[model samples]
Target chain A: MKQSGTIVEKQYFTYGAAPDRLQLESGAVLGPVTIAYETFGTLNRDRDNVILIAHAFSGDSHVAGHYPTDREGDKPGWWDFMVGPGKGIDTDKYFVICPNILGSCMGSTGPKSINPETQKPYGLDFPMMTIGDMVTTQKALLDHLGISELRAVVGGSVGGMQVLEWCVRFPEMIRSAVPIATTMRHSALAIAFNEIARQSIMADPKWNNGDYYGGDFPRMGLAVARMVGHVTYLSDEAMRRKFGRRLQDKEAFSFGFFDGDFQVESYLRYQGSKFVDRFDANSLLYITKAADYFDVVDRVTASGPLKGGDLQKVKYLVISYSSDWLYPTYQAKELVQALKRTGQDVSFCEIEADCGHDAFLIPDERLTTLVKGFIDGVG
Target chain B: MKQSGTIVEKQYFTYGAAPDRLQLESGAVLGPVTIAYETFGTLNRDRDNVILIAHAFSGDSHVAGHYPTDREGDKPGWWDFMVGPGKGIDTDKYFVICPNILGSCMGSTGPKSINPETQKPYGLDFPMMTIGDMVTTQKALLDHLGISELRAVVGGSVGGMQVLEWCVRFPEMIRSAVPIATTMRHSALAIAFNEIARQSIMADPKWNNGDYYGGDFPRMGLAVARMVGHVTYLSDEAMRRKFGRRLQDKEAFSFGFFDGDFQVESYLRYQGSKFVDRFDANSLLYITKAADYFDVVDRVTASGPLKGGDLQKVKYLVISYSSDWLYPTYQAKELVQALKRTGQDVSFCEIEADCGHDAFLIPDERLTTLVKGFIDGVG
Candidate 1:
């Protein structure tokens, strides 16, 4: 479905009935799962030119363009700079599909989704999800679109986790894969940060044990979580360049109780406050947990690597940013090494950028060229 | 006032009567200030052997030795590993005095202290404090004890900030100074973490605008804040070695919502919960704010650098840890550079340790040797 506007309209695809429920890795079952997706460009008659784009933690299916009524400041899809007619993804030559993974709040099944049995928000009762579960659900959507073979699958961060999961679970389904700024398993440091974020949210009394629906939401907790997350998403150099020790509209130190004296503090406070308006606290909890549970080694070895078909022919492009301490270059190297162990064709690149893990989404000529070159070479 | 026990007994020194109030940096007057301190060893006849030890953010006047009736697991003192008769600080050679800084909850004039005007907890009414203010209060305690000059003033982290302040404020009073793992000014990244910690505390309903003294304290928020602080104190390598991806008492993934599946999460939770028991939430807010407000450059250039006495004569030893991202080695280098600019005698070292910002408090042979050598050289 196409809309007559600069923004591509989001389309929904549902599958699985009550008895044919999607069995979660946690043994819980979810049914009538709906996946929200947006497509750019036209699919070839054979549907062989289809490319699936998975989004990161806070991103959705809206990867490019803007809605018809979008105002001047309204953000176009996050990757609007790269996914266009002749941009990196090159909408003119390839059919690009972006899906908001399950367990996210953006028009997808998640903790915010209502439970059919209780008719209330799933909240904490939402079945625990993993990156494999997200990939499985997305695969069902591809099957529904009559795309048996995908030209490419690409993602970064948690989305990148899904991309890796796709390669391991259904290696024969995709011809090429790009997983950027992701890790096979969460590091102790990463888990520590995530746990602190979770603690920040759960500590807020407004949370009321995650049953704050139809009541005051845990905005303070969620905002704190976002503030913490935002700090990790940027490098020390990036923060120094952007905010530094600059004061926040004050001439010298306030020395007052709790004023935002530093520009960085003010910037972080703004980021935290702004995030509460758009993101759900429960969704943050669930999605972060999903990303934490992702371990490609466990999935690949669950039924023996040899039993997972002839995956040697799959082409892999792994990319990382030098300043991304959240998912540093070492993580991408680990993935490339793992892929090599399986005799897969893998190309790795570590871009020198101070933007940190968010570099994958940031517009950079090098990134655009590398992505375009990798996709073109897939032919 | 020597006590006959392994642990030095804490003594209180009160200053600033009703009319002769201590004017704070914020133009607020605070009177009847009390400082808690503990001294080890004996001061020579001329009082030329006194080595003042300033404590870090959460530390107190207790520097070394076990209390007579203390159990085995009871920590002797925050820096018990270093300050002892034969240890790094070398109580046998130098008289050691550790004072709980002003604005600290441990028997010092702080937010938790009663306001003589209202005969109630000061809470948020406590006048905003700075590292300079803390050093000034410490100097008052020394004056009351008839100690005119210190052999050396040493500390790490926030304590280090105070050490820098002493060098700039009362350079003639100290013969040597050692500021470890500290910055001349708070970095944006450091401020961001501190702001998040403050936010975590303030977001809790129990915080009650800092008036929870008579009611339930903001334990949850304080705990979350502690959790966040605890993460910054250790390096990624340290965390990997200590916790890694180990599970918390489970064979496999719990897949349950909000469960501390990872050992690191469990450790952080424990750290957070234990912190609230011994720490005052309001004091935490106030002290962290004090830390954020500390900028040595501002103090150094308040008037003319020449106006401050001959700070050039002070022997300086600035130390930093290699993996301390919170207060990285570069920060120590900056402090040394600032000292050198003023023509001060300075020695600098960046110890290679994976312990992160808390490396100073940890027992390391290199740190001990350097501290001993630096102190001995000051004579």
Candidate 2:
């Protein structure tokens, strides 16, 4: 079977047209929002067969398969290893839908997207948004697709936050949620890292107070930010195993002036440089702030219809990693406890992995078994 | 016992004065090099009643005591808590010598120092030095002080690296040594963090290829670098316990926007800004590079006079904090094993502490006991 033989034609849906617009969690209204999404597998007679897959930070709507224009050996969609036929997320079994989240730069309307009124990119003019606001846009896209109820929804990192948001705001719409390696709220350590990254970007004069559109971008600052993000994504053990103190290019260590460099340093520099090419600096600020502001427990339990000890109708399969210091296992258990208190069906698993926060994105046998069993078991 | 009443009059000793100038580890010759240092307590006639205290990155020779001009409520020396009459490394029992490490801007011939040849700040023109070079300068300072031997040498972090270097390069000059929260060489993870910090500093246009001296400094870039350094110096548990998700001012979270900031964010920003006042961005680059290039095992075991299995004349105490993930206990153990292989008398301890790499700087009773007992027992 050609799991990745399908051409990835970008599909978009516009919302907030006229009177009924998208109201953000901050009560701000987005004029007209566009969502870029991709679909895999055929929709069954019952639209309930649709499953929504959310992408993480630095992720996009391309979750599986290869575009027709791609050459041989070119990388497929982000989760092609896990979402192809007979894979963990098995596109053959479910019609998968992945959207380039709102406020992101990949074909979606975001800071770089032209503001309909000013005829210029939004830049910092882009209204502040929360994970809930992102979920609202996904919900509207589902509404347009006539997908009332989802078979399941899955995401890791920021994408996982979207899964939690979907469960909170539209519980009756989701059958099960798999929030992998993510937290309901960031800890101080996490916030500190994000702040450092944001500071790196804003420090660049080229940022020009977020109005550098159609001009020189804050490439250097954004690269530094990406370097920080890359460090957080990998565990110390993983890094040691991968690079250790090994010098770049297997060069001999010079006794004088320290000419040789560590492999890890160059690897991160490459990751940082690569990120600047595909991402917008302003989107990073907005998205990271949204992530820092995410507090599902507070949003739900603090004076909401789905308050603590209240009923939750969706089943949750929460997954965390052993070495994921960014979010860690304790945070996942805390989220599970919150769900259990709400009398919701919650299954928590702390998968032992040395890969840190990015483990969910990497293909693992146990992750495959757990996610496949959990989502497949869900009606 | 006016432990902190001793005025901190920074005394300078010039070496490399013409004919027999100091030779750097990198094979470069430095001329008219000066070391800024201070001594606590009186050096007895025996001279062996002396100890050396090395400082960490971002630290100066100010190991203890308040300057005479310092008013009430003013902060004392960095390690005033551990270096007073009745404290660890007791100045009452033995005189202590601390010189600002070479290649640092703390009154040392660093990148910010004027080039004798060019009559301008060296900046990028400054020659790179290794941890060994730093050790060499400390030796020169000790030699100039008319001290032939040291009763003990104690330091943590980069200071700890110096202790190890001293033992390796000048084993007969020290009777005992304490190296805390340090590694034989940097792990890939540690190198990655340092790279991020360097990248943050270099990203600023104000850095201007390290030629911004006597001009608009890279304050913003240096601040971001300090922020990254601050995060690494702290443990996750410490940050969580200190700040958690508490907002900066404890205000209601606006639904439409995130006005309430996490306390951690503001605290980091403040730290970043405060560091800009004291540190030189180019000096940070040089010192950190010196640290990354430190490899005691490679220096000692790989083609050196004091090769592995050779005799080491000094007793060694290696200490690491339980939560100091930057230079974790495992790294300390590795260093210990290397020493033991060389027939060196070594004692190792992984102290239980929630604080991270900066645990030694904090006033901890256990650290006090361990350091005090180690130094005194040597005599």
Candidate 3:
């Protein structure tokens, strides 16, 4: 799936045992995992400046630059602003690697992938994945790169969950970590959003028990789910500011159920429709489930009963956006509070950005400065 | 349709010629309409004290008391708190009339009703309806009751739109109007919410173009739609306050997508599934479309061509909730501004309530007191 692109390289790698031996939390193991990754900048002499970037829902390994084999009208990848040289993540200073998560459709092993045993798509039968499972696979990738330690780990939203997971699951692997606009645990409200999206997919008759590979697929359900998730990604103020009472194309109502009467309707429809062409509904289900079930506190708490995790050994910089209602500032505060309780060396900054949860993906001078300064201080 | 054992007597009247024909803004006449109304208190000789209560989405004519005829576990009525004796509307002083709107399945001539011309349910073939059409039918119902004027017309959310429509459609018919937790128009953001809900319904394969009457009837779509609407009804703060990150039953992740991993998920699913048993998907589509097309600002700014409608002359009491992101206080302010600009007698009230868009249905003493005092002052 490598596309020759300017400025960044998109690539893939194999890690661990074959698909039949990948291990599970419940003492089950099945493997042969493939990872789709995009790399920016060059690794240092000691290969110690590596920074892992995890993609969120609907995200892929194409974190920055134009996909080498670009098509007209292709979307600039979700985090393109942050990964380019001289940008927030600064590919010029850091070796950045963004990998499509285990349960995604961006060249990763998901429901859309073929089942070696049956010679058909895995579909619903694909083993349910957890955030820990995703991190464990990333560890395998790091080992393949001969990287014994990472300078830092950074992510936002579900990606932020992965950053936190890295801090817990592989504390020694990361010197500093930044989790932006993310929750410590998936809130009931958060899980509700994912469940509704999953229900929307399964409800589609064309989903065909996740076996609609050669047909129309459940594009409508997938679109609707994306629309729902899109609403969460935006702040109410941002929505109102952008398209309050704005008409679509006409001055008056058509008085019929058709294209759109309001600008937001047209915007959402476009979002939903465009999403289906590049996304798999089953991957949406699997990835959201993975994020919903992710909890760093619970995992660490279980190991040493929530008392023995020494966070002082781990330097943390938590970033939250003021207008991000999906994962509000208080959730970040909660994370800070729990980390403090665990006696961690933690610093928190809530940036007053109005871009909502997507702020983490955009280029904010303040954020860029803070991140660069924090990384320098940790080094 | 009138088998009732409640505080008030049920009245059924055939108003339009077609089962669901209510006149639209295009000078189109809709007929054969049926209205189910519950009138509380006497009409009085002059019928000046009649107050019309427009129910919100999924509401019925039963405004108060448990109907002996109602099935077990069903609600008595949505607005029982505001319409009973000494309540906000004050049944002791005002003759309150709550009517099931024309395009609803609750004893009104909707898609579920038999089209006398074809002797089968109208289903998708039913003429499309607008908020104006609903108001027109309600006016006819009032005419059948021999009420020459109403002291007030009151509603919340979608019902609030009806209240505004009553004033705009028949300014002379209503002396004062209270529209709560609603806007002068469905904002682009609001329309987006409704659009996703409608898309959720239409996407369900079992919908089969709204002809699924006897067999499987898009329950999944309806449920998903309701779930989408439910999220909008509650504020982020409310959800955080109510559910937080609380797990449903087990303290740990189930690692499977069975059900009820979180409390909010269970609550939303419950809200959705419970709604499917009584509501019609076609009605959902029609009512949402009506809401999306409604805009009082269009009436006030006819020269500017906002929506192009005749602005009715009536006093307005526009009420909004502080925590209502769905229809925030800013929207209500827009309504008041439009009415003020049009030289209409409009008073605005911003009620401080923790409840989101559903605040009007809940008994906030401040809101109820403000409403009662305003109604009395207008009278």
Candidate 4:
């Protein structure tokens, strides 16, 4: 239950520096790619006690604890409950690192970052990033730290895709993997939602084809996209239990065009508007495009079963939430099937939770126990 | 297998004339309301074979067959599959009436209609209309036709809500009722989707506070709203079976921000853009607001077991689809429970279909048979 104690410092590693640019999946090159990352605890002498935690879509490198500042009740890092001292991952025993994924605006080289050649923000000019590209940057950061083999690679939602990418692209670096509440690829329904979110962004004239860097932002479009994200992240049961037909302060219907004040409406609007301040619409379009294009099943199927490496060397623990219709439990099982077909060591569990895809981010006794047990068994 | 034969003419009836305005639930008054409706088949001498078919959200009075236009490939009516001469609500036997609900852009007097005082589009000035007002208009139309409802009333989705309103508000006017794929009230999840859809329209700059009647409409916002609606209307299974992860025209990923071209994306965009062409943005806001405000359970409970009406006189048929998550099967069952508690004769069936909320509108053998059998049992 203890915090990570002192705030972790966010360090940056600039790869593909200068003329030698990082070759993206689209055959385009991006240079001086800086990946923002933060690490808790310490790397062991063997450099084998590392656990990489990938962030979700629109997430940053700050995974746990707060930055050193003079503030009371400041919000802690995103996964503080699961990655702190004596917590599920036990930062005191293992070095835990989280890197901001590519195609995101969270201190990473994304659409908002300056193009080395043009000297302007990439905006729509940024090459589309893939999950493999994201994992490649993480591996680059690990190599820089002299950390070769990770004890485990863990992540949920879009972050989980990174864990799977690491499993296939660089299995030698992972002793174990935890891909939680994510799919090898998006189903058509998921694609529909993401497409709608993207359309919402593109529809805003303020977006100006993603070139609105210093002027008015596409606040409305980005907010709508975030609202769609929020709706998908939580399950029907969660919303039903949380808001139900509850109105705001008014006892009767507003009956006016713009003042119906349903509590859920207020919550979604707040979530959307707040997201507008922290996110870039172009980044959302790029990141979601990347996620929608991801398909681990094809890559794994093509690679064949684990190659020459021993199946026991790389372990995978697939976790899914029962109520996560966005990335339903069946998808996790599909992922498990794909992994097993590759002859990789795989363990699967469907956690009974009503919070939907966001369940892994929330603290639960069963989840903590399962994660701790898996980690303890790993190293 | 015959069509409705001749395309029925849309008829209009004016009621709630000026001076005596229709008092809305919000205490706002609207006057000289005009209800646009269409009728097929013939009313028997006893006026006892009437079957009122309410249309869904964004639907119109044209319930069966095509228009009077001479196009060879013209599309049929919205419910043509189930409302034709020899189909479910067989026009050959029962008199069928379909009324476009109030607060809609389709023929009915709505936000797009000219306000008497302003002599311009009501726009945001249009008073909010509820399911009750919609049913009230239909009742007025029936009175003008010198017909007393006897055979049955049928509808699905938002239309289903209207059907329920008619049951509780005018049980004495019915011999039976059919409400399909609907809820007595919206769940918080449903409310969340509706609220987000409303926000999408309101966020558009071209909306101009709903006064963009003679200028550029909020096409983008309205399209996004339609996209959201499309997502909710189809089931995950349906989407997966139809589109999967198929790409459009391209063999590989576009690797660009906007050209990923997942088939699902193409479909949703088309659906959204097409909706913008036919629908009024302000009407979506008002109609969804009214649907959100509807709570038949409260009104039904207050009426106390049909107000001592004969349980066998007015029968009820509640139908739901297996994969219609928007309304879901449980909501229909909930309506059944309430109807039974009120001592009204009720029959319930959950049709197994993977098409989601739109299943009832599509041609299905089981649904047609059920409707035919229920309507036959009525007269």
Pick the TM-score winner: 4
- What lDDT, from 0 to 1, does candidate 3 have? 0.80
Clashing pairs in 4: none
Q: Write the per-residue lDDT of candidate 4 for residues B1-379, one digit (tens) a residue.
A: 3333557778888888778888877778998888888888998888888999899998999988767763666677888888878888888898898989998988888999999999999998998789998998888888889987657889999999998899878877888888999999999888888888988898899999999999999999999999999999999999999899999888987776566488888888888889999999999999998889889887765555446554434688899999998998888888888777766678899998889999987889999999899888764
| Top candidate when judged by DockQ against the true structure | 4
* Runs with alpha carbons beyond 4 Å of true place in candidate 2: A1-4, A253-260, A299-310, B1-4, B253-260, B299-310
lDDT of 4 by residue, A124-152 (tens): 88888888898888888888888888999
Among incorrect, acceptable, medium and high, the docking class of model 2 is medium
Q: What residue pairs are clashing in model 1?
A: none
Interface RMSD of 1: 1.1
Predicted complexes: DockQ each: 0.82, 0.65, 0.59, 0.84
Model 1, span B1-379: residue lDDT tens: 3333357678899999889989888788998999999989889898899999989999999888765667666667888778888888888878999999898889989998999999999988898888878988988888888998988999999999998888888877889999899888788899899999999989998888889987899998999999989999998988989999999999998887567999999999999999999999888888888888888875554313675553447888999999999888877887777677767788999999987899988889999999999998886
> What is candidate 3's CAPRI-style docking category based on DockQ?
medium
Q: lDDT of all the models against the reference?
A: 0.86, 0.86, 0.80, 0.86
lDDT (Cα, tens digit) per residue for candidate 3, span B212-285: 88788999999999998888888777787888767788787666666667788888989999999989999999
lDDT of 2 at B300: 44
lDDT of 2 by residue, B197-230 (tens): 9888888889988999879999999999999999
| Docking model 4 quality class | high
lDDT of 1 by residue, A239-311 (tens): 8888888999989887764678899988989999999988889988888888877888755434235655544
How displaced is residue B32 in candidate 1, in Å?
0.8
Please give the C-alpha DockQ score of model 2.
0.65
